[model samples]
Target: MKSESLWFIFINASLINNFVLAYFLGICPFLGVSAKMETATKMGGAVTFVMLISSMCAYGIHALLVAVNAPFLQLISYIVVIASTVQLVEMFIKKISPTLFRALGIFLPLITTNCAILGLALFQTNKGYGFIESFVYALGAGAGFTLALVLIAGLREQLEFAEVPNTVKGTALTLLIAGILSLTFMGFSGLGS
Candidate 1:
């Protein structure tokens, strides 16, 4: 990853190895907020913002920990930073768009617990990515997550009027859609290399 081109890094993260579809890191928001395209987009933006901030902070924090020879604290430190970043994003969204804030409900602050953010930090560090590489990776992961959410939302929206069977409705239908979407992403696996 240190020598990988920025384009490759972005494409790999956003599509080939997507945090949601490939790694299944952030299923909570992927399913919860994906009920509507509007909410899904907003959640995607919020998650992306958090990922960007956390990526930068993770880069700095990893360097600082290594410098101090306290690498054991890495996991706890990442959680703390992710929590704080989510708080900042939550407050900012509340101020700029109260409707969205309410619309997101529990899932808004749930970004802190969304494993995709933490996974982004950990994956970049493990891959030995530099600051720029980490940033692009985070951006790609966020983009991929948004893409998955939007796709599911759009499909779920369409399913509403398809007159589906009663037994196959709700979670069953959502999971069925998600499984197909995940397989669809698998077709892009070759592009990462």
Candidate 2:
């Protein structure tokens, strides 16, 4: 029973209720950083790392807040945890790959405010997921986010070679592709239902 629920949560988070395609969260990074496969992959990795860490921290903080009868602090606590985690990722990227870090630019720091991360924490808490469940949910969300970004990046890369019209060449084409992708993802909403 426990395993079944966990599996459902994972699948639901990663596919059915995908943060990008379904919820439309984190569109900033999705549109801005998905121009190239390499940058998209890095952004995905960073978000996954932050999501995992923030999920764990949110779980612990929620528990502590509950124990202390201060559940109202959940939002603030999650924000602090997410911000700190993003900072760590930013510093790590800066140290390891200055080039990638520069490419990421302001979008990297903007992860702190990414609705997907905040939504993940809030949703897990609302769903009353346990520690392991929360971790799996975070992982699923991260994977789903990465999958969406990579798919869009791949499409955009291919689009570079295709002859596009003057009006639909840039953002117009990107938006059209995003809409198509969202509809395609909606097809999976009924799985295991």
Listed in order, each prediction's TM-score against the native is 0.97, 0.95
lDDT of 2 by residue, 1-193 (tens): 3445888888899999999999999898998998999999989999999999999999999989999999888898899999999999999999999999999999999999899999999998888889999999999999999999999999999999999889888788888999999999999988958
Clashing pairs for predicted structure model 2, backbone only: none
Per-residue accuracy of model 1 over 1-193 as CA lDDT, tens digit each: 3578999999999999888888999998888889999999989999999999999999999999999999999999999999999999888988999999999999988899999999999999999899889999999999999999999999999987899888998888998999999899999998865
Model 1 deviation from native, Cα RMSD in Å: 0.9
Best by TM-score: 1
TM-score of 1: 0.97
Residue-level error in angstroms, candidate 1, position 10: 0.2
